[model samples]
Target: MVERCKACGFCVEFCPTKVLALSSAFNSKGYHPPHVVNPEKCSGCDLCGMYCPDFAIYGYKLETGQAHVATAASAVHRAQRGPGNQSTGVEDEG
Candidate 1:
């Protein structure tokens, strides 16, 4: 998804854990995409994906009992509903 990033820095600037930083390397689109800076600190909150206008980045947590990995598409979908309902973007399957 680095190729989809447009160097807006929203992912880097808005990450709650500061897990992302703008990379010096350029993408094919000539924009600097964000890279993970501190993976251990990442909460997999997907805030970066929520903030990305280009749908470029996302994060997901893995739990012992979880059946499926949370998807970035869900995070992006939730973001469209506005800011008040933010969650971990993990939907439980019944």
Candidate 2:
């Protein structure tokens, strides 16, 4: 989805972890899309996805020993359900 980006820099600018940076490589549309600079630093906050107008990027937290990628939406849903409500479709390996 990097090609779908419009070089708006919103994602890069708003990223709290500074995981993304504008790459020198251009997309098919001749726009400089973002690239992950420090993936380990990413907290999977999904702020990039929330700020992205093109929906080009999003973040997910990977639970240890789980096959599923917990997305931002699911995280929020889990939070709303409060503690002890681990009924998400993605199973926890622990």
Candidate 3:
């Protein structure tokens, strides 16, 4: 999947799972937006998207009696990090 990021970094500031981070380089807009630097600790909760000003991140999950839920933020996390999250970062709520 394409990053579809504008490098606004708003998602990073609002990511509850802290799965996203600001890239060192800038995007086409010359902004350093958040990205899935670790792809292993995402909880697929979609908190970031819920608070994103530009909806840069997305997450998705399948519920199979595991209590997992599919969300735009969760889908974005899954797209980059897969199903398991092993990384850790600061928990910022927008």
Candidate 4:
């Protein structure tokens, strides 16, 4: 999904899954936003949004031609705890 990222790189640097990377292209603000370097590596966890200062980016789980935002408060908790959080446990309501 396209995001209005500010190119802070927080999403890339803090992403546990490391699916994101700085794109060669620059944003309107002249900063290079992160891109999907490996779509296969993405887990659609909202950890990127947790640390984003601009609140410009977040990930969504694509299912049945629809996208659901991975937004459980526990998602941040699970991220801090460890891996195996491939989908942010979408049903975990914190």
Candidate 5:
């Protein structure tokens, strides 16, 4: 699959693994789309796709018997545990 992301940023904000982020550039919808900043530490938890409002994010199972982010890794995943998605960089001031 091509990982047809809409760049809505919903998944980036709700990721539990803090692996997703909004691209500095905009998508076709004029929105800064979400992309994986890191892969080595991704853990392939698929939390991004779970809470995505537009289903823009998803997990891809690679041939190596491992699931991986479909795109090139790009943001630093700042893992935090709090009352909300803020723990995952989804909220700036949560």
Candidate 6:
């Protein structure tokens, strides 16, 4: 959030959890930028950064159940998503 975002809707569209929303205020360029409307629901997927043409916004996976960037959170997300392995399409049976 240091540089001015160019109001490219890529981040908002690519956000898996739909955490971003266009703000009512405009940037220096007079374009409606986005803001985190739902931080708690974010998973730090970073899809926004990958899609953002301006490289203005990015998200960090929060695993501590708190709304902030943390290294531990990233580790937790990695563990949850996959441990460098693809799903085998086999369901676990208890």
Off by over 4 Å in 3: 1-8, 63-94
Total backbone clashes of candidate 5, pairs 3 or more residues apart or in separate chains: 4
Among these predictions, the greatest lDDT belongs to: 2
lDDT of 1 by residue, 5-93 (tens): 78888877887778667778777878876665555456667777678898777666545311111222222122223345443233422
Would you list the rank order by lDDT, best first? 2, 1, 4, 6, 5, 3
Number of backbone collisions per candidate, in order? 0, 0, 17, 0, 4, 0
lDDT of 3 by residue, 1-94 (tens): 1235565566677766566676565556566655465455556666766766565555545352121222222222223333564233323222
Candidate 3 achieves a global lDDT of: 0.49
TM-score of each candidate? 0.66, 0.66, 0.54, 0.58, 0.56, 0.61
Clashing pairs in 4: none
Model 1 CA lDDT for position 59: 68
Write out the backbone clash pairs for model 6: none
Residue 36 lDDT, candidate 5, scale 0-100:
64
lDDT value, candidate 6, whole model: 0.53
Q: In order, what lDDT does every prediction score?
A: 0.56, 0.58, 0.49, 0.53, 0.51, 0.53
Which residue pairs in candidate 2 have backbone atoms (N, alpha carbon, C) closer than 3 angstroms, thus clashing?
A: none
By lDDT, the better pick of 1 and 3 is 1
What is the lDDT for 5 in model 6?
A: 65
Instruction: State which candidate, 2 or 5, has the greater lDDT.
Output: 2
TM-score ranking of the models: 2, 1, 6, 4, 5, 3
Q: Per-residue error at 78 for model 3, in Å?
A: 6.1
